[model samples]
Target chain A: MWAFTLRRLLYAVPVLLGVSMLVFALIHLAPGDVVDILVPPEVPKEIADSLRQRFHLDEQLYVQYVAWLGRLMVGDFGVSFFTGRPVAEELFGALGNTLVLALPAAVLGFLLGIALGALAAYNHGTWLDKLFSATAIIGVSLPHYWVGIVLVAIFAVVLNLLPAQGMGFEGLPTSWEHVQHLVLPVVTLSLIPMGVISRLVRANVLEILSQEFVGTLHAKGLFSRRVLYHTLKNAAPSALALMGLQFGYLLGGSILVETVFNWPGSGGLMNLAIFRRDVPVLSATIVVLAAIFVVINILVDVLQALLDPRMRR
Target chain B: MSQVLANLPRATEPVVSVEDLHVRFLLREATVAAINGVSFDLEAGQVLGILGESGSGKSVTLRSLMRLLPPARTRTEGRIRIAGHEITAMDETALRHVRGAKVAMIFQEPMVALDPVFTIGVQIAETIVRHEGISYSAANQRALELLEMVQIPSAARRLKSYPHEMSGGMRQRAMIALALSCRPTVLLADEPTTALDVTVQIQIILLLRQLQQELGMAVIFVTHDVGVAIEVADRIAVMYAGRFVEVGPTEKVIDTPAHPYTAALLTSTVLGSTFGRRLEAIPGTPPDLRALPAGCSFAPRCRHAQDRCRVHMPPEAVLAPGRITRCVRVADGELDLGSPNLSERSIAKP
Candidate 1:
């Protein structure tokens, strides 16, 4: 089992390397950069030359890529072009901020999804099933940013219940005062995942319920609840596989949601870097997000193997 | 040990009895009459083999004994009394105690029948814990003993292995061990050996017979193989469509089948000495269960179907003593098929 985990981790290395290369290349391949904003309509050529030389934009694309990759290996993300702030510091703070919202939202969404899915699947054709199914469909289908705007309009604007946007604190949310700033963003971020996870869980539970062993369990005189336990255990591995991917999506896909709330997360950071043409901050955020995604994939594989003995090989 | 003491006063009463059981599967467009009207009584320590091809309602009959049919669309009617518990009358909660405690079933394919995620020991022990209310450790010990009883090698180690890790035959052994764990009064085996290798098939049959005798438990063994039925059964019930056409002592039924359907079934198998005795082959397929004829279900396939035979279902005609056949032609004694003690007369002529 340890060997399986190790092998999966090893497999992830190449994928992450590929993602790093792409993040670097794709960001650099864009049309404009800090150079465009830095230079005026008719600046002195030597001043522009000094700016280009300082950031090494004057170097060949391969040299720039190799240099960036080399520095990245040693944990240096370079300084931000607009603010002259260290990219790593800015990136980590944004990641921590994202974690505060995404983590709780994920927890809420996942737990609710699993509960609703199991209930709906066991009940199958009743009104409860239809109600939950409709909820899940609406969740997955709706635009989350639009949902966020409506949430802000109702709670912050109309009811005067909660603060509208931004992290109340400078960093991670710890106290309740800072946490209230979380309501709209977390709810907006969670809707799509709740819908996605619940649907996956429902389908898996329904499929497992029909397997032949469920009849065997029934024949064994197991209580209906006991039979349900067996059904859920079998259903878990597949549901968990999707949950892992959804977790990655929750963190990475919360960009627009974060933008609407004005929350300081990687999504917000990337948004700022994109407009200002801050290549260092942009490259660092994308690579870090891509790396997090790869790690999630590995964790899902290992967790699935643990749950299902058949996957040990 | 506990079974023998309980068997004294109830030895005369059949361990399992079903009367006029009917099963119908209600689909969107049609209602499938899976089991029309089947009746049987199996006493303690006896094995009644139900022989039939697919869709003959044999498996459906076995499942009906436990009320295992889906409650949504499938309807099961009539009395099923196993170990003195009225199966059809019991509610879901009451049925649980009677299910693994009084009546248990082994399925056709062990790999499919056994829970794949759980270890064999866990599956077996859970049953003991559920019905017997024993401690988990005690249940585990009993589970180990059961695996050994089923002749599983390295029993202790094998207990921890998942179903997929074991061979087909071993998994079936695990299945049997699990079935017998709660010491049910009767066991319903639905083609238990059908998915095993041919060589393993005999071994499982022998093991079942030996266990049944040792435990003195009644068993309703459902199978498609003629040899398997004859090998394990004292009495044989040959089913056609949804009802039993003939049921008698194994020797009597095989040597001189009173019903034409039974005769066709016997001749179709490539058994020793019974080979090339294909006097008549069954024609066409089983009737679409959704649209069964009003009269005898086998009339279309039977060569001796008279106009009357096509008009009314045959009554269960008792020839002598325990021999019963569902065929109108049997009443006339012109069956050319067989009469009671026909095997003796045919032997004497030779």
Candidate 2:
């Protein structure tokens, strides 16, 4: 197993390299220049040229790529256009902020979704099943941004229950304050995934409940609750597979929710950089997100292998 | 022979008795009468075989005895007394107590009937623990004993193996072991060997017969194969269109079949069909129960049917001791029933 894990880790290297190249090329191809945005329009043409050369923007695209790739090999990700801070440094802060929203939301959504799914599936054809299934359908259909706005309007504006924007109480520690601020955005982002996860789990459980083995268990005089839980355990592998794929989707969807909520995450950084035409920051952020996505895929593969040994062969 | 008759398990009462048992399946669009006024008795240690075509309600009848039919579509409308208890009227809680302890079922497809996620031992032990209030360790020990009794090779090692890891025959054995774990008074085997190979089918049949004798448990063996019926059943009930056409001692039913449907089934056994001889076949399929004939269900397919046969249902005629057959012609002595047993008399190719 360790050997297989080591092989999987080795395989991730090429995947990361491929993602880096694609992100690098796509960012370069997009019609915008950090130099054009950095220097003012009123500045003299000669000084602008001098500024461009100074920032190494005057080099050919290939030469620039080579230089950038060289820096990337040495753990340098250039600098942000507006802030003039190293891209890697900004990414670290942005990633930390992003997790503050997405991670808790993912965890919270999974727990609630699984419980609801089990209940709905066990009580299938009853009012509880219909109620929870309808809620999930409505939740999945609503956009995260729209949900965030509505939540803010109701809780922050009209009700005065929670603050609308920014992370946490001002006087408290960073982590605690950030955690408090995370609630609304996390909920907004998690609603869609929660609905999806629950529906998937419910469908899987319901399918398994009809299997002959379940009938055997019932005939064996197992209590209804015990039979339900037993079916859930048998149905878990399918649910876990669904959850693994959904986690990757949740990571991507979090960007939109984070931007809408103004939660100071990687997504917020990307949105700001897009407006200012900060190529280095945008390219670095995309690469980082892509890297995270690749890692998640690898994790999912490993989990499937571990859970079902037949897959290893 | 007198000593053998004396050694038979006869307690002056049947372990299970069904009287005028009717099972109806209320489908989405219409109601299907699967079992129509079927009645039978299973004495302790006696193996009763129910032989029929697919959808003849033989399985439905057995399921009704256990009250194991799907709740939404199925409804039982007659008395089912198992070990002198009216099981048909019992509440769900009361039924659960009687289900695994007093009566148990082994399904057709053993592969699908055993839970895949759990080890075979866990599943077998669960039946004992669930109904008997036994500890896990005690249940496990009993489970091993049950497995060994079924002739599962390496019972201890096999206990840890999941259903998917076992072969078809082994899985069937494990399923039988599970049914026997609770030491029930009756075992309802629903086409237990239908999904197995010919040799494995014979092996399971022999095993079941041996176990039933050793344990003195009445087994209601449901199957479509007449060969299997002849092998295991002391008495046979032949069914068609949710009603019994004939029932008697296995030898009597196979030899002197009184009903035309039973005659058709016996003659159409497809003994040499593989050699491309269209061995005399039954004329038509069993009628749809939703729109059954006003009189006899088999009248449409019966070549011996008269106007009266189509106009009125035939009642069961007591042919002789331990023999009964449902046929209008038989009451009139229009058909003779002195034929010899086919399986017992026919010679097989070497």
In candidate 1, position A232 carries an lDDT of 81
Estimate, for each residue in B239-350, the C-alpha lDDT of model 2 and write its tens digit. 9888877889877787778788877787677631234334567788789988789888999888888888888778877888657778878867887754533443344423
Ten-residue segment with the worst summed lDDT in candidate 2 chain A?
Answer: A168-177
Q: Largest lDDT belongs to which candidate?
A: 1
| Candidate 1 residue B215 C-alpha distance from true site, Å | 1.3
Q: lDDT (0-100) at residue B241 of candidate 2? A: 83
- Model 2 Cα interface RMS deviation (Å): 2.1
Deviating ranges (above 4 Å) for candidate 1: B1-10, B272-280, B339-350
- The CA lDDT at B259 in model 1 is 90
Tens digits of per-residue lDDT for model 2, A76-107: 89888788899998887777766666677788
Residue range A124-160, candidate 1, lDDT tens digits: 9889999999999999898989999999999999999
> Where's the lowest-lDDT run of ten residues in candidate 1 chain B?
B272-281
The true-structure Cα RMSD of candidate 1 reads 3.3
Residue-level error in angstroms, candidate 2, position B79: 1.8
